[model samples]
Target: MSTTTKTNHIGRKISRIRELRGMKQETLAEVMGISQQSISHIENSETLEAEKLGKVAKALGVTKEGIENFSEENVINYFNNFNDNSFSNSQGTFNANNCTFNPLEKLMEVVEENKKLYERLLKAEQEKNIYLEKLLGK
Candidate 1:
């Protein structure tokens, strides 16, 4: 049997952290005052300079050490543990009555509001078109 070692690629860590934060290359670039092409280059490199790494960390809203030590497995484990704790009490009891509101009802409310807004806008546009046509006919 052979031993295997994981390679710690700084660029890959940065890319993963950026993705986890729901950030796009363009967004990070804008925050760092760099171009999207530059962000792409940084994400492809295995290593980065100290100053550049600091800037990237700041732009991503994490410490430099945080980015250096980032791991997908750790993130997954963290969220798994968080989810397990979210629905339980201190005595490890699940509470079924903890839900405050119905998600489907909230979604239906938003849809209905959007539909009303769209109908009003459509009616206004139709009235404007009718007025323009009457003027053109004169």
Candidate 2:
């Protein structure tokens, strides 16, 4: 018996990224000014023209290279490693730079956890502010 592995396929890569982004063919089609059928066809083909690929990349909010190099395993590995909370060495002490913690991810988690408090603070700040509307011609 022989075993074979398929290499990267541009169309499949596009479909995967689009699906991961929670987008539907209809939505992508609308944004690209093409019919949903066209989007389906594009997703099934192995190659796409550079110009058309640019349009698809723009609609999906990613660069063309991102779509071309998309790898599900790599993405899964990234998320899995990101969820790992162990930041200590064998001595059980935190690293000086906290290499295991992603600052942007932590910031986003904090923002989400305090959404209501943030909204309230913004409202209070706005209420305490004073603004005057000047007459247009005066």
For lDDT, the strongest prediction is 1
Worst 10 residues of 1 by lDDT: 81-90
State the lDDT of candidate 1 residue by residue for 70-134, as single tens digits: 89887776556565336433467464446689999999999999999999999999999999999
Query: TM-scores for all candidates?
Result: 0.58, 0.59
Clashing pairs in 2: none
- How close to the true structure is residue 13 of candidate 1, measured as C-alpha lDDT? 94
lDDT scores of the candidates, listed in order: 0.89, 0.84
Where does candidate 2 stray beyond 4 Å?
A: 84-138
Residue-wise lDDT of candidate 2 within 18-53, one digit each (tens)? 999999999999999999999999999899999999
Error of 1 at 130 (Å): 54
